[model samples]
Each structure stands twice: as structure tokens, then as C-alpha cells.
Target: MMYQEYVDAITPDQEAGLKRTNGRMLANTILQNPDCFSTSDRASAQTILDSINSGVQQDAVDQLHDDIEECVEDATDEYSWSNC
Candidate 1:
């Protein structure tokens, strides 16, 4: 199967796992750095949050694009146009 197909097959499951992992990471960070949520730690927290959010958004977009490609491929295959 193509890489895109693999991504399309795995994305939804991966997303759930990713969310759990992110939740654990946040919990650990809070436990390790109790002050990290304070006004004094705003900069650090903001940086971490931004990075996590960006990564999640990118993953979601990539997965969506992969799924769309797979759907198009399936449609083409149904019509026997998949020569690639």
C-alpha cells in the first residue's frame, strides 16, 4: 500500500492515542513544574502549548489530506483509471 494509504488507515486511531499522550505529558509537566502555570511561567507555558497545538493541527491536516487522496484513489480505481 502507498504511504498515503497507510496514513489514511491509521490516522483516527493515531489521533486518539496522540490525545492521550498529550494529556499525560501535560499532567507530568504540571507535576514536575508546579509553578509552570503561574503568571511568571506564562512564557514557558505559552511556548509549550503553541508547539503542541501546532503539531496536533499539522497531524490532523496531513491525515485529512491523506484520507482525501485515498478516497480519490478509490474512486478512480472503481472507474479503472488507476494506472499509477
Candidate 2:
């Protein structure tokens, strides 16, 4: 089956799991639903999911770092320090 078919076949439970895991559940779903996904498809999905998850994590960390820096800068600045 194509990737879109596999995606469309995902059950409500799997959808919830995907939301909870930030899509990390995709690899596990591919493994569990072997009837829907071929071995090569599973491998490709896992690789893609890993790359996406890694990028998401890095983006989150970058945002947190930026927020922290902004907060610190605000706290140190004489005009904004009081509000911070």
C-alpha cells in the first residue's frame, strides 16, 4: 500500500497515540500494521519519522533557548527589569 493509504487506515487509537508522541508512534504503527505496510515502506517511514522528530526536538530546544535569552535580557535591562 502507498504511504497515504497506510496513513488513512490509521485507527482512532493510533491517531491519539500519534498526537501524544508527537508522531513518534508512526514507526511503531508501521511495525504493528504489517498487513498495511511493506518492509521497505516501514524502513522508509521510520527514517522519515526519525528525521522529523529530530527536527521538531531541535526546533523546540531552539525556541526554549531563545525564550530564556529574551527573559534574561529583559530582566537585565534597566527599563524592562522591573516588569520582568
In the range 1-84, model 1's lDDT, one tens digit per residue, is 332343344444577656545544554454456654565455554565676677779989999999999999999888796565
Clashing pairs in 2: none
For candidate 2, give the lDDT.
Answer: 0.69
Screening candidate 1 with a backbone cut-off below 3 angstroms (N, C-alpha, C), the clashing residue pairs are none
lDDT of 2 by residue, 1-84 (tens): 544554566657665435435444556667668898788978876886777677778878999999999988876786754654
Question: What's model 1's lDDT at 38?
Answer: 68
Clashes of each: 0, 0
lDDT of each: 0.61, 0.69
- Runs in model 1 with CA error above 4 Å? 1-41, 81-84
What range of 10 consecutive residues in model 1 has the weakest lDDT sum?
1-10
Q: How many backbone clashes does candidate 2 have?
A: 0
